[model samples]
Target: MMKEQWVKDLSTIVNPQDVKIDEPLKNYTMTKLGGNADVFVMPSTEEAASEVVKYAHLHKVPIFLLGNGSNMVIRDGGIRGIVLNLSKLDQIRIDGTTVYAQSGALIIDVSKAAAAKSLTGLEFSCGIPGSIGGAMAMNAGAYGGEIKDVIVSCKVLTPTGDILELSKEQLELGYRKSIIAKNGYYVLSSVFELQKGDQETIDATITDLTFKRQSKQPLEYPSAGSVFKRPPGNFAGKLIQDSGLQGKGVGDAEVSTKHAGFIINKGNATASDYIDTIHMVQRVVKETFDIDLETEVKIVGEDLPTDKNKTL
Candidate 1:
């Protein structure tokens, strides 16, 4: 079947308005610099999301699940096949001390909701820019706390279209990694277990953390936060800074002068430029300190025709 036919069929299964053809990924990602996706689907409910996954699998089309796009970089050539977005599926409910959130629910929203309900454990996520699904997939952490510490369990849709509930132990979460990412599983929703705390304290903590993030991160530019994972016995930002890689640029992509860990898109940057800058930083850092820098941001799609076979 042709790509257009596939998109049309998907539109029939989902809402016509929810399906977009040749959708520009730049509008969806934080970097604001990617090409068009052949098909973009936003499912408003779990059933609709599951159906889209099943149909795409049966049709032998590639499927990519997009969260808030806070921690990802899509190539300038864009994505082929279907891009499944759960952005419209956002839903959050608080039951006692537990927070039930849909995959599309923003991490910040969840944190705010938790605080309003006097829940404490989620205060650490107040500044995270991604969705619950993306946070769970990477066991995202900040301010000395992580998702795994509060996540009781999560509902996931398998690649084969089966929905399964997984316990925290089953997630196998490590630093900036999780079993869901390793096994190619899609998170449908998550139930976080938090504690009752004083509302004043929670609010103050959130406020303090937000201020710290603004002071340390380069919020004025477009870029994925914290490009590299912290290497063992060392921090990625400290390593880059020590290597004198701050303010380095290739094209419009520059190593942030304020934060060495971030590679900011100064303006009109291509994926190749972003990636090349990353490589250069890595090479220099490794050669100078003998510490191999591993990326935390998920880089996807084809940047160049010749890079189709290259692994991110």
Candidate 2:
């Protein structure tokens, strides 16, 4: 249980209204399945965010920085300490051919901003649902373009609350991983360098990618996109589909028939259903093809007690 005094103390660092106790986390994530966060804090400014992080560190409470929750699953038993949501800090600005985006700014929105300025190189991320912070943490990429290609530098808050500016090389961006993730650093903002381009050409590229995504991916249902990372020299989706695991599910969680890479919440699905389905797919793929499927989706929090005969 969260201590009342501890909850009240958070108000000293952030607005009282922004601090919540036993806050439901399901409302925050894409899948909309989870219990509660013992302490949920939303700071609208970088200064306030830093203060909160520092206070949590000083108090020895566990802290998790949450973005738009586009690629995560919070387990059924909920999160124990602080869950810092950066959604309120969204901001974006354009200067010449460079884009300055706050961590909370959506990547899709940033891509759109670049297009509006007639800047090229960001059209690839026009459909990604994640925020800049999450994108930086995972080196998020799509349609042959990754954040590393455009990012000039980033501002981040260290776990101990010190701010640092990291260049692209310093970020150590890789396929679905970065130094921010390895060190649990909190991204504050980023600068993306682009180039002047014809508006017609940029618009055409975005249109093409959007069509490809809508046609191939299952956007109608709720899911943490691309459940598993691509194994070296192989695609996770192809392996699952070839292994005949399509449409397989536990309860209401199903491997998307449209795209095998996705696991969708088929309405009334529990976190357990999603996890169990993931394990089932992994086990089947490994046994059938002898290739391991590593999860790309971030799974956090705790699970409900194992039920010998669980229902729903």
Candidate 3:
């Protein structure tokens, strides 16, 4: 199908206002970097979302799901085909000690909601920056807690646009991995099992975690949180710091001096620069400690085409 015809059909099913052509994805990313999306679609309802999923499948068009734009970096050439963002579907509901959150709702917000009801078990997630979908996809963890501990079940869309409610056991969650990530399933919403706890205690824990995260992480600049995953029995930041790689990177990107785990966008940095900086850190860390650093952040999209006329 032609781009114009498919996009028009897409707009007809979902709201036209929710559809965009050649939309710059940089504005949606946490790092404020990325190229344009061929066709950006934000469906406010599950019905519309499913329709879009089927549409893409029927048309044999490529589809990519975007959550809150955390923990990912899109290259400069942008994404082709349909880029689905569920930001408009954000909704959170609380019933007793159970928290139900849509994929687009921020995990941090759900943590706050749980706290407001004097619930526990999610205190460790108060500072997690990704959406619920992303959290589920990655089995996101912080401090001493992980998503697998509290997740009861979740609604997900299969690659063929079929919806299923899966239990925690079915999720097959592992360290920074899940069945959803493994199979490319699209998250819709999730139910979490929390416990009633002392309001004062919950508040205190959140405060302490928030303070530590703020004081230690370079949150002022645009970054995709930690650039590399923690190696077994070792820390990525310690390795980068020990390698003397702090405060150095490619072009406008830099390995944050305040937090070596972060690669910050020092204004107008391209995705290529950020990726190269990550490679540099990996190479140095491997050379110094013989440890192969693996990236935690997901990198996607394509590189900008080089101009033949430009002199190297």
Top candidate by TM-score: 3
Candidate with maximal lDDT? 3
Colliding pairs, model 3: none
Error of 3 at 145 (Å): 0.6
lDDT string for model 3 (224-263, tens) is 9988999999999999999999999999999999999999
What local distance difference test score does each model get?
A: 0.91, 0.92, 0.94
lDDT of 2 at 208: 96
Give the backbone clash total of model 1: 0
- TM-scores for all candidates: the values are 0.96, 0.97, 0.99
lDDT of 1 at 14: 88
Question: Number of backbone collisions per candidate, in order?
Answer: 0, 0, 0
lDDT of 2 by residue, 176-244 (tens): 999999998999999999999999999999999999999999899889988999999999999999989
Question: Mind sharing the TM-score for model 3?
Answer: 0.99
Alpha carbon deviation, residue 159, candidate 2 (Å) = 0.7
